[model samples]
Target: MILANNLTKTYGNQIAVDQLNLDIPQGQFFGLIGPNGSGKTTSIHMLSTLLQATSGSITINGLDVTAHPQQVRRDIGLVFQESALDRMLSIEENLYFCAGLHGINKSAIKTRINSLLDLFELQSKKRASVGSLSGGMRRAVDIIRGVLHSPKVLFLDEPTVGLDLPSRRRIWRFIRNLIDDHKLTVVLTTHYLEEAAPCDNVAFIKLGKLVSEGSPEELIEQLGKTIVEVSGSNAEDYIKTLKLSAEDYMLDGRTLLIRVHKPQPNQVEQIQATLRDSADIISVRKSNLNDVFIWLSSKGQGTS
Candidate 1:
């Protein structure tokens, strides 16, 4: 239950977000993705009432964000890309400070903190200093701080940026459980495309504008059912022999990606056999979110 209409943000003569519009339904796992400086964060800041939009309208749960920022803040949680915890403080202490800021009752704060720590399996580390924890643990604590007050919507900006694969998966598991248990709406922005594949809907932004929006599966389907990638010094030359249309392929340096719609097992076999000698590497697999992102980014900026 969030709506933004004609949202715009500018810095002097340069525009950071331009006439952006979005309508996120309740309990939806929505994703906002773009390259660096594509205005994803600027849009999030304006929507969260941390920064004001130059000209636009935003409403959360029927209240205008700009007109009623205080009320809006109470309905949302934010976990920034960077850590927001006080490193010197114990994990429990950092959560306590956040709960107080959100005005949770003194009596209920301890119970809330303990429940969250248990959920993330951080109960034993509650007494540990934040700086002493591993990167993954600190990030988990940051999320615990954000949702301590149980806000209806959670905004996560690059929540899994630097974590290892296992840690990232663990964080997503926690987030998924939170959403399922509490009916929380999550709005996420991440550079890791594969991590976003589970989102109900995702929007791509470029040059401060909406480039494309759809379910991850729907977007990837636009690429094709299968992706064939060939890489080597001769890859580009070899791709020309396939006689594929320009729209069916993308070339990035030594690698060439070709979209094969509804390819049969035999078709894949034939393609691989043809490239066996000419290419150093050849792979044929199901298309994925990264393929969709690369194709979209390539079309927008003339590069991948």
Candidate 2:
């Protein structure tokens, strides 16, 4: 339900986002990923109407975001990387305050607040001050506030940045349930690569340009089926002896990562035997989104 055409954003002479085009369908879990300073946040800010684009157009549910920003704001919710909650307010009070801002009916606000609290399992702590809650609990409250208005689209930027693994998983589970139950369209940008694996589609941004866009599976398939990582002082020499081409491997200091396309039984044993003597560490595992991201980002620097 979100579309952008030739979107661009700039600051002084530096372009933060350059000619990005995106089409996110309704109920889709879309992800925007890239390294730091790649303009992921700038793109989100423009799409969410927090920052104006330098050129091109963006639409949310067919309404032009730039031309009709106030109207577009009604259709989307944003959960920023930083917490937006008031530490001094009680959890219930925070919800009540946000409900007032959304113009919810006075009588209905209480019931809605209770329902959300129950869903997030924060009902027992409704009266506790936000400052008294743990980091995970506070982040959960931030999410609750963002969706309190029941907007059709939700924009989450680094939603799980500082949380522990369990908290991160809990947050994602809540997001998934929100999408399934409410048919919510989610646009996410995160540093954690594993989190993007569940996305319906993901786009990589670099140097303010769109480098690649595809399903997680499609992107990973481009790098082959498995990644064999060998680390040792003689790793480069070992790879050279194997006659592996530059395209088939990546050199990261002491570690050499080799892509093995559809590795056969004999090939696996052969690779192990070859590395056993020279490598200090050898690991063979399924390729993942992180590998695709690294390959694309490094490769895109010269081309994009």
Candidate with top lDDT is: 2
The Cα error of candidate 1 at residue 58, in Å, is 0.8
Give the TM-score comparing model 2 with the true structure, all chains together. Answer: 0.91
Please list the residue runs of candidate 2 whose C-alpha ends up more than 4 Å from where it truly belongs after superposition: 261-276, 301-304
lDDT of 2 by residue, 72-138 (tens): 9888999997888899999988888888877786678778778878877899999999999998888
Query: What does the lDDT come to for candidate 2?
Result: 0.88
Best by TM-score: 2
TM-score of each: 0.90, 0.91
TM-score of candidate 1 relative to the true fold = 0.90
**What are the RMSDs of all candidates, in order?**
2.9, 2.5
Per-candidate total of colliding backbone pairs: 0, 0
Q: Could you tell me the lDDT of residue 46 within candidate 2?
A: 95
CA lDDT, every prediction?
Answer: 0.86, 0.88
